[model samples]
Target chain A: MAHKSAGRSALARVLAVLETFDQDNSALTVSRISKRSGLPVPTVYRIVAELLEMGLLERGSDRRLHVGVRLWEIASRAPRALGLREAAMPFMEDLHAATRQHTQLYVLEGCDALVIERLSTRSAVTNVTQVGDRQPLHATTGGLVLLAHASLHMQDSFLSAPMRAYTPNTPTDPAELRRILANIRTRGYVVCDGYITPDALGVGTPVYSPSGDVIAALSVVVPRDGAQPMTHVRALRLSSRGITDALGKPQVRHGPQNIRLFPFVNNEQL
Target chain B: MAHKSAGRSALARVLAVLETFDQDNSALTVSRISKRSGLPVPTVYRIVAELLEMGLLERGSDRRLHVGVRLWEIASRAPRALGLREAAMPFMEDLHAATRQHTQLYVLEGCDALVIERLSTRSAVTNVTQVGDRQPLHATTGGLVLLAHASLHMQDSFLSAPMRAYTPNTPTDPAELRRILANIRTRGYVVCDGYITPDALGVGTPVYSPSGDVIAALSVVVPRDGAQPMTHVRALRLSSRGITDALGKPQVRHGPQNIRLFPFVNNEQL
Candidate 1:
């Protein structure tokens, strides 16, 4: 059934139309979407029309296509992102208030670290991360923390790939990266100085679910030359614990689920 | 074509399925989704399978399904929501910090106020609103403000219906509501006390796009029994203006376009 089409699923094609609109290209003509998605112009038009009718896609006053609020409304209802964010918010806010830096929450999405939420200050160090953005497992503090607790197979797959280097200080070699991951596992935290950008350093800790599975990573980005990043590690760990504790609460079960699904595993796997 | 099948398109059915998930019911069994969307269980399953394969939905640990991270990612990339939120954030942050209350940014979405972003303290007054949640035009300060500045046709159509009243203080009579909207239009801000919830008060102001259209509404929610809600009206107006000014900047143009598709319009013929 899977091999029926090297041509992607209709759903995938539909997603392709949505994926075409991003931070850089927010609005696109049907031709642009067609070219980007590699779908025929007629197909793009039909799909776009269907999506618009479904309120999954919308057209702007400029006659260009964009994502629809209905999509966001549906996505926002997702328990994993919004629920976890809701539970973590009070704690994240406490941490943010204390540090007044960049506070972020991330979860493992495939092999990459997906930032679910982030709060930044103008006076904080510069970082390339944004909410709903992704970063590699080897380069980010949050990614490394998640990678540290990930399944051995996931770790091996990640380390086997040639890690992209954002800064000279990033660990690209599999052996060295393996050692770093081990260290993170042992220390219960990961700190990367200038791994992503030259001017910033990040420290991250894991957030566990009720089952003690490391479901997400919490991190703080600070200027590389500023106060010891280690000092903030305690706060990060505390905030992570608070979030995890909140997740374990019955009230949180009533909150939205922010689960990320990987086809390779079913519910029983967790 | 429009009259076929209860005026519902295939796309509309798909949207209905998506819309069934909200903050209250983020994860749903296939049966629940089918029931909520009024689609047959078989059709819901088929479409949901496609949506799952497309990364728009994910199965949770409970074996139920929720909105997928990919959906949020795609929606976040929509220029209207993400773009407007990005430009509005710094200003929103400033407003939140200043007011120490719930500061929200909402755009008119299909005759309702759809909150795109919000920042609040944990101890702040309780609000029924959430990011991606929708409020009726007559119930929220933001909604009222947006409705006041809306086209005459929109105003007439909105007031023509029997509006749902959340609290006794909520104006159910069209004449009284009309006066309130007119006052908002004249005063340039709205101080709504116990309109939605008896314990909260809302202060709202309009946000304009570069073209001078009232593209969004900015509001602050505070405890009803605390200081007068009008005290924050000026601050809310300032922040709204600040967001409008920031949105007008040249670099802020390319944002997710889907967020800009406001759903509510006056269909006088209806």
Candidate 2:
């Protein structure tokens, strides 16, 4: 069941309802959902009634609907998301402790860099990346790392597309970006100084899966001034290797560890 | 929109299919979904087909249907789950750094202790609480903290119900548990040594919302031997106060910081 491109299916309509809730637009009335989803008001109510029944959608005392804990609970089991996040967490934590900057993990999805997990202290540089928020593959250090490891076909397609420049330092020329991607692959990491923001520097390394494929990117964001890029990269590579090792051996699963943690391994060993 | 306890609606059937997959059962076949959800094989096939189209479910190379990244993307926006997780992360990281043990943030959901976020290194205690997993109310320190703060009617109902005993230390008698909850209320923290596992000790404190209602609990798990349970509780209370202060200020909502970290505030200040 690839898709029902012939017409909008009933399930698509339900998904549209869920789509209306996001980081900014979390709580909404039925009419707002109808407006956002482009479905009729009556249809919104009917679907929301079902979602509410399933506890997938909750109505607050204020009578606005929200994405429910049940939905988040079910979604937490997605292997591509939480599984990767789980494998990356301890390493990310260690990297954060060492660098005292922002540490982020990413996977390539739909030509955009999807942030799987991010850790930052309040003192981190002014970086505007959030987990699950997609960034342009050309603008982010993690994105370039993934693009470097991505299929040639995907690379070619990305190179042919126009690049958006957020700042003077963002690499906008496709040919130059292709060369940067090549350099990233050769070095196993990339340092994008002021790519997203003027005051930020991003250093990213490759994270491998058990099958030895570069499945994700682990990146750190530090302040541009006096930033030791090589030092950060070295620390990041250490964590990346740890995550890779954890993935190589099937990670022992335990917790509600954010409700539990993987006590099977030791901190010093990593 | 409460619930139709009568005949199943189409959305109800869809929810049944989604609910069949959890922390343990991530992948399932059409037949398995049918067996667990109690829907017909053909019906399961039909719904799975639609779910696949919507990218709510994905088929592996092995062809086992699993929860989709798209669904997780949608659910990640859940304010209660990720919102709290985001607000709690930096402090949890600080606590984890200080204790180097398991750090968890939990919200009370229904009658169970729902884990919203957890962080730990490889050498923490043996506890099986995941971000989305639920634990018995009377068995976990976080659960008891929330129970202590719950409404009187809710407290009475829980106290009047049968409590399961997982270990010799897990409190089963409502009267004894009630006294323990009272102590928790008086001291503003709870320490449960060997409550779930003989080797693990759990220390917990309350996390309040902006309105001062107990919305969640911040907890830590350490090795039972040389645990210094009171010491852990003291550290937990510090982070709990930080979390509560951050929450009390209408927690600056930004990113997946973990469970509930106030990104707007700096860590040095905390």
Candidate 3:
């Protein structure tokens, strides 16, 4: 039962209404929703009424609309987000505790890196990454790691598209990025200094699935000053391996005592 | 915009299809979904096609359908879930680290407690409370704290319902529960020893919003043996206060350094 008369499906129009609510513009009026979704006021009102009835959208005490807890409950069943985040949380916690910086986990979604979870120390750095936010696959450390391991077709398309340099140090040259991706494959990690932000340094490593595919990237962002790259790289590689192991053994869940952690490798000394 | 042709609205049908996939049945085939959601096969197929196109549902390599990451991204913008979570994570982390047990946050929704987030130590204690799962208001520690602070009408309805005793210790009598709930309000915390599980004890405290309404509960589940209920209560109250402060000062954000933690009350001595 698509909405053929409306020129778009009913689900599409409803999604348009939902899409208008984001991190910044979470609460909005009906007119604002109509403006944002490009739908008529009556259409927006009808959709909003149905959504409110279904508990997908809630009107706040201020009378502005917000995404409801019911929608969050429904979306929490997403295996990709819930499973990976659960598997990676302990390792991420360890990394965050040790470094007192930002520990982020990202998955490759449609040529962009989608942050699934992040644990940040309040005063650690100036990184702007937030959970559920997407960043370009070429300019961020996690993005580069994920893109390097992504399908060759995706890599080709990404390289062909015009890229933005968030900072002067961001490598925009496709040839140079290809070399960096190749090096990341060889080194098992990547260290990007001032790639996304001028004052931040991020080290990224790939996390694997049970079938040996790189499912996600685990990264740590620290301030540029006193940024010991190898130390962060070693910690990230170690944690990513832990996540990979956890992902492979779904039966052996959550107990730190059950999983055997890998010994620390002093790659710099080596 | 509503799906008037079908018996149920289009959005309702879509929600029904989405509801078929929960934590246990995350991956399913169309036939199974049709069986579970009770929709016609062709109707389910058409809806699934639309959902797949919109990236709300995904087909895995095994040919089973699963909830997509795009849906999770949309749900993550849910202010009720995300804002509370971001405000509570650090405090939960602190509690989890100090106690090495299950630290959970819950909000009262429709006479039940909806677990929004939970931090568990692998071997701390056995807690069946997964994030997004619901528990009865009269049975769980977090539930009682939330129910106690909820509207008087909600409390009355919950008390009138036929309750099941999960264990011998679960409070089922309306009079007894009312007294316990009243005690909880007076004490500003709850200690449920063997209420749900005989081997576990839980302590819960209320978290306030900027407007000072009881928005959520911060709780810990620990092994009943040697369970210092007072110790757990103190930690929960402290963290609940921290969460309240964070919720109030939205601009101050994540720096633990900025928030002044309250001194331990030593309530036992008092």
Candidate 4:
């Protein structure tokens, strides 16, 4: 028998404290954390104390709290993020060195594309994407590639809603987006010009797992006027395939199998 | 009034569950988690359900649970880690490109040297260190550098203990360690040969904040019998200075001061 009306388990409240932290508010006073998480001040204080003792949260000289290095260490050991990033790094490095632009690796999390890792050159074009940042499925090249290979249910849900346009060139109409997704599936890659910003062009391709399922997307963002975008796309595809091959290796296969497959119909190409 | 003993608080139990997953065990079943955390099976089940719903953890097809991407995203945005990481990346990249070896940035946490970031070449010498791994204070070059410039109480407490000898060359005698620390302070860099591992050499220098307090250590590890370790020491010193200059920039300064000066006498060379 489960109690449905506990109003939120102690676990949820603890997670709530962690969730209160974000990019803009990395450090917070206990009162602020309480306000942000909607946890009672005393409860927040007690939870914060326990977290501090456990090394999940740390306090700085300012008396404000921040995420602890121990938490990062534990999370880094997680097979999903670090495992994929390790397998993808050498390839990502090659792509970054060759293009001398922004190279990113993303995995689909629910309805959003979560950027797991990114490398950018000093003179690269500015983009809103950052490691650990989320982008809409219809507005980013990596997101589009992932969305193109995503399940039919996900596609229907994404297409049913009004898509937010980041720039004038972004395909907001569900019909046009549906066509683009079809083309991505057929062409094995997706390239969008000024989709997120007028000055940037994004190109991406899918990465596959051993079972030939599209597991992630690798993309490069370059200035719209920069060198031919096709070159980056070709490099990304080659690198993505290399990563897939790496994933197929037996050593990495022993890790978690939570690799979510993009629900594309034809899995042969991947 | 505080609850005398609210079953260790649901938050504490949840943290214990997360804490049980580390580098050695990244994925576990509910039974394993219960056993490792000493929590009852029924309680573990209920909390894991809430955690899965909140995307704090995910269950793989094999029915094993692992840390979730959502947790990583939330932790990644913390300014202490990401902000420092962002500021240090360019310099770290430069050091890595130039040396083609293992380059690391670390800060003092508790009694260990906590690596905040690291970059390594595939062919570089084998190092047990990872991005968030912690190494003993006296046995690591980075730790030694941080210790040399740490508060008198910290330095004494660390040196006073019987240091764990990781390798035959590791400095264990407190008097000898103090002498070596004095040399590091005078030379502005440290060359630790066969300290952490017999096959490796670690070189390190202190990174200072705007107020000229040591906040971190920058180091490089290379093969013991390879080229002169002094070269890496020079590079580390230069990179440390570069990071200190970056930290001194007015645009980056925010919040309360975290600078704490070392209690030892300032040697002019450093």
Q: Which digits, one per residue and each the tens of the lDDT, describe model 4 over residues B1-270?
A: 222224676667777788877755677899898888888788788888888888778776557888876788777765445556666777888888887888888877678887877887668886777666787889888899988988788888877777787778989999999999999899888888988777888888888765677777888887888658777777777777777666555332111222322111111112
lDDT of 1 by residue, A11-49 (tens): 666767778776657778998887877777877888898
lDDT of 3 at B41: 81
Identify the CAPRI category of the predicted complex in candidate 2. Answer: acceptable
- Quick one: ranking by lDDT, best first? 3, 2, 1, 4
Model 4 chain A weakest 10-residue run by lDDT: A261-270
Estimate, for each residue in B1-270, the C-alpha lDDT of model 3 and write its tens digit.
222326888888899999998766778899988888888888889999999888888877677888887899998877677767887888898898898889999876666788988887566677777787788889898899988887787788879989988889999999999999999999999999888878899999988765667878889999999989998888888898888777666444222123222111100100
Which residue pairs overlap in candidate 4's backbone?
A150-A263
Fnat per predicted structure, each in turn: 0.46, 0.52, 0.49, 0.38
Q: Model 1 off-target regions past 4 Å?
A: A1-8, A250-270, B1-13, B250-270
CA shift at A111, candidate 2, in angstroms? 2.8
**Cα RMSD (Å) per model?**
5.6, 6.3, 7.1, 7.1
- Candidate DockQ values, in order, are 0.36, 0.36, 0.33, 0.28
For all candidates in order, the CA lDDT equals: 0.76, 0.78, 0.80, 0.75
Locate the minimum summed-lDDT window of 10 residues in model 3 chain A: A261-270
Per-residue lDDT of candidate 1, residues B15-107 (tens digit):
777888876677789999887877878878888998887667889777888887777877876555666777788878788877788888887
True contacts kept of 4: 0.38
Tens-digit lDDT track of model 4 for A25-86: 67789989878888878888888988898777877656778887667766765555666777
